[model samples]
Target: MASRRRSLATYAVATLVLPLALAACGQGGDEVDVDVTGTAPATPAGSSPASPSAGGSSGPGAPPSGRTELPTSKRPTVVGTVVTGLEAPWGLDFLPDGDAIVTERDTTRVLRVTADGEVTELGTIDAAAPEGEAGLLGVAVSPGFADDGLVYLYVSTAEDNRVVRAELRGDRLGATEDVLTGIPNGFIHDGGRMVFGPDGHLYVSTGETGEPERAQDREDLGGKILRITTDGDPAPGNPFDSPVWSWGHRNVQGLAFDGEGRLWASEFGDSTWDELNLIEAGANYGWPEVEGRDEGTIEGGPSGDYVDPQAQWRTDEASPSGLAYADGHLYLAALRGERLWRVPVGPDGAGEPEEFLVGDHGRMRTVAFAPDGRLWLTTSNRDGRGTPAEGDDRILVLKP
Candidate 1:
């Protein structure tokens, strides 16, 4: 397992220039310029654009009454910000003892946040991450926390971005150990997110390591999601016994599961489309070959197929980040898009996804479903994007 992961260090070094080489995406546009494949992502025929809000900003907009629609299609209200002043916060996990673990990109540190909004520095990793788009990113609570008090983190290190495990010691994380290393790193494509699925397996999302072409390669770890155990071996019954669950993604930063156990992923597209994907094991998603739901054949993929995107939008509308599901819907944080989007889900995994909140916050990052069923969100203006409203980086609770 280590050997396979180690193989990526070379690729990480070789393909580390993709973000600069790729064309600028979305550059303030309403329509996503379809990729070379030639077809735009399909939406319901009657789909109309959302209205602009009180603020100058607009897109898939926030509710007119200063509210949001619940997962049940009801209106939603603000529940107040939980924590504030997080610098480029990306992922979070609630602890067993009424606390939460948070990741910071620039600091390369994990923070433990208390209920009263106090944040204590946990510890730092030796992540050799590149600036502009990489650093400490994802955190996951151990399924055996009671016995081992372990927490897992995915980091973008300068040497290589990888996953590491640390023992949780009250407010500090102790004794960090590398679990999976050398997963391809770069300024933009070093994907840093991980989660423990219900099946007791660890799932990880990786980027194309700055190389768009790598996304289409099944033999490469870049642009793939992997399922592994605590020790970083591929989960059982993987396609071809590879650690990958799904492949051919540009950069997947957000992942969530609905009540029916369907996994949804959020992807960052180049120049045009931003994607929301319904994920299944052994599935292929078109990336470099196809950007969104474009009309054309995608070549050089597993089974040589072109997979369609579930939902897509111009990057101005939804450059989606972390994802969460509640009230029978999925809520995704839009980064470059600066909004929160709600997608209604049906019993059989089909539903129309529409943008719900825009301009309420700036550069939304992560959306989490708390244990008590409250919907929580975080903003990322501090990492540099929109106008930061004094202390704009905040964790907000959505009134259910």
Candidate 2:
């Protein structure tokens, strides 16, 4: 039972209730204000191929009611193959044995889903993970897994949500140690995504516990990506004096490093905007201050600085979730969009985010590249959405 910081009082609660969402709305005019949080006005989808900046409405939303039959477009259909049977998997990672571990959000368990489609129940964490948006979320393997036997996980517990490290034995997880704790613990804003950066340090994406204002708070871990060492201390040379690597995000769900070792993050925006941002050290992404580039103007006021998203969606195309960089492209999993986006990358961030496998599958949650050079993706169908097939929860492999 750990206590939150004194600063996380009101703003943290704001992120939990729906009202705080209004703060994410980017302010109009120039020079965005730091404290003003407002809702982003509803806008149509923008910038498709040809002229990406061009705007349009979101494609068909989730099925009208039960078992909504999705339309199939004649676009490039990415054939999906079942690589393994899994639970409601949130994050996927690979082990040295070529086996992969998948975290089940609601069931409070982890599975070693092998490439052969066999699932080995790897015990369960009976602590706590409230439904709505919380549960056992992102996971990352240690760089020294071969020697350390350590596995890191971001979980939402009844007491609080934070990052924990443990050892992986045969079928059970060994002693669990808390690396980082006391992040706001709402059903949302747990900011449950984690990844090992190129520098071998852990880079974590934490939601503002629904408190949009905390996204802009330098002293808080909410709505920010934190860089920490294996022992849970802030990595040396961090942009701020704290564990924060980047801040001012609504809910950062996805994290991936490009071929050049540049980090990219995908976020779940408010009703209007969902985003894909290139994460940089000591950068502030507009959250309560600004939503996207349109509202991040300098004239709006707060000169605290802001980072623009590489690409954004009309809220429909991108309940942007887990992301993985592979095949010279950045693959992002869309939870609300029910699609996978392939964002081409250059020296900067993204060039064009092409919608692949549109409506071909259900909601995509996590995407990871296997050592075999194939893409492994997880679906979120079981989480309060469309009907799950006989094998409701599953892990699929995609190969070009």
Candidate with top TM-score is: 1
Among all windows of 10 consecutive residues in model 2, the one with the lowest summed lDDT is 11-20
Tally clashing residue pairs in candidate 1: 10
Residue 344 error for model 2, in Å? 0.5
Task: Give the alpha carbon lDDT tens digit for every residue of 1-400 in model 1.
Answer: 0000101111111111111111221111111121111112122222212322222111122222333333432434454566766666777988877677888776676888765567788887764353767777888999899899999988777777788899988777787889888688777766666777767888888888779777777788888887889988888767758778888788887877666666677888787677666675666676776676645443444455545655566666667778887768777777777666676665444355545456667777788877766667777776645556656566776643
lDDT of all predictions? 0.65, 0.65
Reference-based TM-score, model 1: 0.80
Pairs with steric clashes in candidate 1: 25-271, 39-294, 39-295, 68-76, 127-157, 127-158, 128-157, 128-158, 129-157, 129-158
Deviation from native of the Cα of residue 338 in model 2, angstroms: 0.5
- Candidate 1 Cα outliers beyond 4 Å, as residue runs: 1-73, 128-130, 296-302
